[model samples]
Target chain A: MHMALKFVLLTLLDRERITGYDIVKTFDSAVGYFWSASHQQVYRELSKLTDQGLVNFTSVKQGDKPDKKVYRITRSGKQELQDWLHEPAKESPTKDLLLVKLLNLRADNVDVLLEELDRAIKNAQQRASVYSGIEKTYYSKTQIAALELDDLALFLALRKGITSITSHIDWLHQTSAEIKKRVANNN
Target chain B: MHMALKFVLLTLLDRERITGYDIVKTFDSAVGYFWSASHQQVYRELSKLTDQGLVNFTSVKQGDKPDKKVYRITRSGKQELQDWLHEPAKESPTKDLLLVKLLNLRADNVDVLLEELDRAIKNAQQRASVYSGIEKTYYSKTQIAALELDDLALFLALRKGITSITSHIDWLHQTSAEIKKRVANNN
Candidate 1:
């Protein structure tokens, strides 16, 4: 199960009963900047959660439109989310194939690794820029200029992502320089 | 199983056949920069791997000391490592309880939230400093400065981490200032 999705479900439950569309809208409005789930994925997860009895849904009809499903968290769902929250964090094991291929590069042409790193760095930078734009759109200079202490945590997470991506770009430049130096020395 | 332990085992296997003590030495020499495994943990893992037939060990008599067991990876072990390397990446889910409490500060004292954010910012800054040290130790002033394409990939990953932490610090400062401004305006 996706921990972030579970957390999102619990948070929605904390508020009053909401429709699937409403949950999607809320996520898009608030947590969407940090956590993203496509509408289809959200709908599918909602159904799964309902089947698991973690959530209950009631059909509501709007004028001339198909009946909409509204959801509320069950007591069991809340308990599960709480339990997960209190659990000690498991170490994140990341396997970037790019890194693996790079590790094997001494036996191959170095140009391949250089090209991949360049692409990867560009990708990271693009993501960072996109996240920055999302932050700016959500929290205006005037709005950020007026945020209360309680409201700042989300912004901080956004900043964390930005910081991480920027540092990655800087490191890429340095590493590229080092590789070039080694090649020259060998020649 | 700790994925870090697996990485350690694989790295050791990358070198020639070695005893458990030699594995520890290699870890201390190179991997210590990015990953750490206790001596006890290493020995235990080695024994477990041997029991599973993932590694073959040969008994060697030393002068006046207990017999030592030198280990080499079996074909099965290499296959297992390769399988693990090809596994899909798992998305990491992070939920900081501290942030949750801060987000709810609207129901409590604002001063508490401010103090919490201040403390958090300081902590993050300290972590960034540590990462900086790791970078200095691992990559600083190396003659082979240019990364071949593949080597560049690993460098980029490290860079991404550094950039992320630094941006986090910057976001914290901006958010703190925003909260202060809001409080002043409201008063």
Candidate 2:
């Protein structure tokens, strides 16, 4: 799991040859959904991957722009990604900020926490709507049938995100009610 | 969020005065629910916190054993926790290996992934059940009412975990079915 960055890099390279800057941009949008890394970190990892021979890069010159290095996954990198895909997935540990806040909440702050929980629920709803749009665009039966394996896999990941967010929203409402009841009783 | 280690240390200190070793043990069981840190990292963080005056420990000698430094939260630490509790939580980026694998899946690996998904579903079910037992034991309404703010916070965190795992289990089943359908169609 700690080598998640490597997988992210390999996954990107598997799609198309890319430069460090391109990887950073892609990470901010698509890959950002699943992972976050700094531009510097991406460059650092790219260099390390190149050094390890898991990835190789070639210089590309543009007419008006400075020359750039475009990286591609080596055979070893592809093999590594395949091996990792077969490993059993462990549920990631909890790192939700709202959950952390809930765990350390003071009695006096119950009202504020409830308000924040409501906000979180609304946020989750917005995210779900956004993800559902993507689903309709790319993961519907017709689309899924047409997609190649890589695209289909991404669709599956998007599906998980949508499903997980929807469930979290449901729980937020239920937990909100529960907390409100407790507060009422205490008062 | 990068200061997560600080919060982890404070959360434990707020529970009771505990040694670095105790923190390692607690992380493996209780704190293991939401966060992970190596034992060496825990020791390092404890020393850092002590230096920062956010936490302080007194060295106590044990007969025929080396001295132990038991740490406790300082006033500053408590204040910091309160401040953090009020700060809005950003959605932690997704890092689930299953999702990552799914995003990069190969066509031939569908069968293997389905088997693993089934295993993951079982694991989520087991985790949810375990969390339910803990809820029954320690987070019943009566127990919650009697608990201090810190305990209540922990209860709330536990609630989120249960909700999340249950949701994840539901998603896994749904995803499994979807994958099966795809596999059948492809075959």
Candidate 3:
């Protein structure tokens, strides 16, 4: 299955009945650590899933708030998710620009490559910091209260992101130092 | 702009001319660490890119070897790569079954989740080991040659992979301990 289908399946798996906002919020809170989907995309996917009979929606009203349309996964949706899991994962092609620039770096303009690498490392670190904060505030609280297994799984994913980012940052530091030494010797 | 396009562009950028085998080898050596592509997919993409004039190929004869068609990127290809760099990165959706199963774990089947987590951590560690080996081999050779700048960048990316994998393994260990504690308290 592609990304959109995965999101729909994940959304239903998280809760029994969730409005579109709830679905977006669920991704924001948990899956957003790794996978990101805008509200427009989520709503569009929800409509498509409903049309395909993979999910069903119920309209409910709050006292003063806007009417909420809650979605539930159908039997077919569960089957689709299972089928997807059984399929061998598609090998995703590498398309990272940082790697592209690194491969292109020659003897001439090494400084530009170094700068790009620094930028990538910093971006990764920023993302890691955000995930760390999310874990401390949300996942940690959930772990203490209900001990929900889902929250625990999400916490683990966040931990993965943090580790990945920290690794990038550390590598950046080492690489930058090495580049500086090379520049000094050359000059 | 897509995975296929990126792979083709990176392959062309690596050298002025390369056959399918050379492209595949490059992927195996470097891109495989961060991105993966199958031989079939690579060949198909090359054909598509050639048709689109993003790349050009010419058959050449080696000493007593089979004639091979080597590919080079066109000016259009460089423009495409630059355009893609300016676009915001699209985050791929996370679809880890091990995490999904863990989220649904009840007291009756906590062992299953534990086993899965154990397996996942093991796999991650194994990957980390491979990446570490590659880094060591690459750095040792490059250090002797005094190609310090390129060596530094390669080492940085390699370290990122190693650290990320180690983090996953650590998180798995901690999560397993937590699960065991919860099981004991419940009993």
Candidate 4:
């Protein structure tokens, strides 16, 4: 497993006590916007974090459903995350499939490029709408007034997602307009 | 090898006739800004493209130096690229390590978060500067005046790269300010 997964789990646990299922749900909800991990990977990493003393799990008895293990960061886990977070993360080139396709454009295939651009714009708009919904549902005005530092952290992440997507949509529109102009000129 | 590498090479070869060495160099330059490919993956994919008849290469023998195999896109390869470019790409969640780390921030570790944000800003600025340089060198006003559709394609990609990075830097600064304000509030 990637060491990044370990830190992702540890950092998540730092926010709140959550069961393995909640961890997966959290990923699907907001964390998915930044990084991805499989359910198996999350469960596997949870056990490893337990053994390493980075996290501890509590068994809560339930009347009907099976007892669940709620997990949270231990002292050592917080220490570990603090140390790791201070380091400068290396940036790698992000793969934008539409941008790659854009480089394949030819003069005669202006419509093909336009078709691709339209699809890309639709995709980005869908994402931005979903993100906007998440922001409203999870970080409402009332919630914002009462936000803890941890809540602020997630809020910031959500904000980042919306802004980035907005930029992509802007670029898509600009590219579309520029291509249409070039076609009009027949240069 | 990933199928993406195949298209990356074909799209590149569509622009010019270049050897295996030149492919690697191009990847490091403009192409490297969007997608990543190792030299070995590129070499492997090049041969696969040759076998598939989507690309052809000419072996030019040099004096004392080893022979060079220069590659070019076949007609079929252009058709392949054009067809693929039409399809709407599935969007995946990009892995941004810093954003994940931000979700782990605590009130007491404001300075730690600040340090991380500082590093992120530096990394982004460095990349944005490099891309700005590429834009100047490869797509100057004089060059833009005479650009073919292929050059325009690359220019659009470069322009997209700059806008995206600029947005990230803006986010980094805003997040830093917001975190500091929260620390001050202590509410």
Candidate 5:
């Protein structure tokens, strides 16, 4: 976790105190589409935040288990988050290995690449449906219209994921057909 | 300069024996849209490939200038590329810092976020136009129709970049409007 994930934790903490375990689960269920952090990374970042005095944890003792550390943002964390929110957005470097493969396309390898394209289209479809499931389970038309500010933010983030995957699948379909046409004509 | 960039370099070398300087230029002009590596990273990876015997270079002496190391793909490099092409494509990890920022949106700080969105839209528009210029410069309708295999692959890659930026701009417009409406209503 770096600058982005640091602020992600602060945003979550600002809303409500949560355990590291809960943060992991929350990310998988809600934020995984937009951002992801592994268990170790999250734990490590949590400690780093504590070291910087940006967050502190309280020990909550359970009946039979070890005491859990429930983390909450400090005042300085809120200030830091506010400053970051005001910073200019840049197009951060992103890698699309599929595009890299396309950049290296060759007739001899076209068949294998086509197979991979088919697999990718299927995978994108699956992801789109899964995101749709989450949208339906958590938000309805009426519910979305009436959501509070925090809920609305979450809803918008979800919408971005759904739209992106839909666009991706559409592009994949067109590209796959074009490649097949080119290869078949050559043969 | 890991598995993906390694293949990228090999792909370039497989096509022609070129200097490291030319490879850097090629990436900026053709491959930067999909994948990027710093100059240092490219040089380092080239050295690594040479050590692994996947790529070999020859020094060309100029009249008064320093010798240039022009590299070509070894037979083993071609084999490595073939193996990679056949392998299943995985969705490599990519981070969109913009999305991370969106995930952290709050009413109090949304004003700044909107400004960032505006900047992002303009930046994307500039990119879209730049890609269009490249497409026009390198490909015409009749020329595209008569293009050979390698040219077609390059054309397709350029088309992908254009389409993606268009979709991104569309989403940014809708999202910015929605965010503005939400913030206004709360105020």
Candidate 6:
């Protein structure tokens, strides 16, 4: 198993008792901002964690939906999470495809490049909206003071995401405009 | 072969006829900013590209050192790069381990978290210095106006990188200070 997926699954389970479906939903919404894993990957990791005795699950019969296993972190899981928390993490290298395109762009593809920039701007804006919603829902003023250290850490992570997306959108706009200006000057 | 690495290598070849060692050197220095691959991965890809007739290499006899393979992009390689430039790229999902740590932080690990933040700030500063050197060497005022479209694109990519690192460093400082303030308030 990839160490990242293991740590991420443990992180999610450490939050609250949740079904695999819930993990998938969280990955799609909140946790997905900083870490990405497919639904299948989450389910696979959940099974592995269970087998490893790191997480335990209870089967709940839903009225209409299929029977789901609601997973909770074990004592062992808590110990692992605590150990992982104290361990130093290596910074992941950047692997942005848009940056790759910009580095490799040709003069003939300027229009296509602009289209890509537009797409990126829209994507960043959408992410910004999602992040803002997370902030409002999870880090509201009334909730802020009541937050434990762990919650505060998650809030800080969310804030970092918001900042990152905002900066990215600004850079996209600036780059798009600069390219247009350069093209116009050439003409 | 990973498509991203292939395009990156082709992009490098498009700039100049460079030896394999030069590609490795560039990967360690400039290209490492946005993408990453090990030396073996790069060599494997180069061999695959050569086999596909997209890249060709000539043997160079050095006076003292061992012989080297100087690689040049072929017509097919240029076409592939152009095609790749036009294709739409997905926004690569963020996968930051520090953010992961923040999300999963234990209350007892606050001191370690602060240490990690300090480490990150130092690393970002080091990267910022390297980027500044590159900007000075390649994008000086005279070079900026005289840049060909391709060089201009590389310059724009570099500027985006600088902007990203600056934003990241700012976030680190802000989060660090905020955490400290919160700890004091709680006490």
DockQ for each numbered candidate: 0.20, 0.57, 0.30, 0.66, 0.59, 0.63
How many Å off is the CA of B51 in candidate 2? 1.1
**What clash count goes with each model?**
19, 0, 0, 0, 0, 0
A66-88 per-residue lDDT for model 6 (tens digits):
99999999999989988887777
lDDT of 5 by residue, B1-187 (tens): 2487898888788878998888888767787787677789889999999999999999999979889998999999999988888888878544567776776677667878888899999999999999999988889787876777677777877887887788888888988998888777877
State the TM-score for model 6: 0.90
Best by DockQ: 4
Ranking by DockQ: 4, 6, 5, 2, 3, 1
Worst 10 residues of 5 chain B by lDDT: B92-101
What's the TM for chain B in candidate 6?
0.90
lDDT by residue for model 2 over B21-137, one digit each (tens)? 988887677666777778898999999998899999999999889999989999999889878767776766666667766666667777778878888988888888888998887
Q: Return the TM-score for each candidate structure.
A: 0.60, 0.88, 0.77, 0.87, 0.94, 0.90
Error of 6 at B116 (Å): 1.4
Per candidate, native contacts kept equal: 0.28, 0.64, 0.27, 0.84, 0.57, 0.77
lDDT of 6: 0.83
> Per-residue CA lDDT of candidate 2, range A1-187, in tens?
6788888888779879999998888767666566678898999999999999899999999989999999999999888888877777666566565665676666777877887898898888888888888777656776666777777677767777777787788778877886777677777
Q: Write the per-residue lDDT of candidate 4 for residues B1-187, one digit (tens) a residue.
A: 1377788788788878998787888777767878877778788889999999999999999999999999999999988987777666667666778888888777677787788898889989999999899888777777774778787878888889999999999999999998888777886
Model 3 per-residue lDDT tens digits across residues B90-147:
4344444445445545565577667667777777787878887886776675473376
Better of 3 and 5 by lDDT: 5
Runs in model 4 lying further than 4 Å from the true structure: A47-79, A137-146, B51-53, B137-146
Every candidate's lDDT: 0.63, 0.79, 0.65, 0.84, 0.82, 0.83
Give one digit per residue, the lDDT tens place, for model 3 in A1-187: 2463454454455357777787678766666654555788778888888898878888988879988888888888766765544443443333444555555555665766666666666677777778878777776654554656555566666666676567657766776676677777778
> Could you tell which candidate, 1 or 6, scores higher by TM-score?
6
Candidate 1 lDDT, A103-178, residue by residue in tens = 4344244665566667767776877778889788877877864554445656765665666567667776776676
Stretches > 4 Å off in candidate 2: A87-92, A140-142, B139-149
Docking class of 3: acceptable
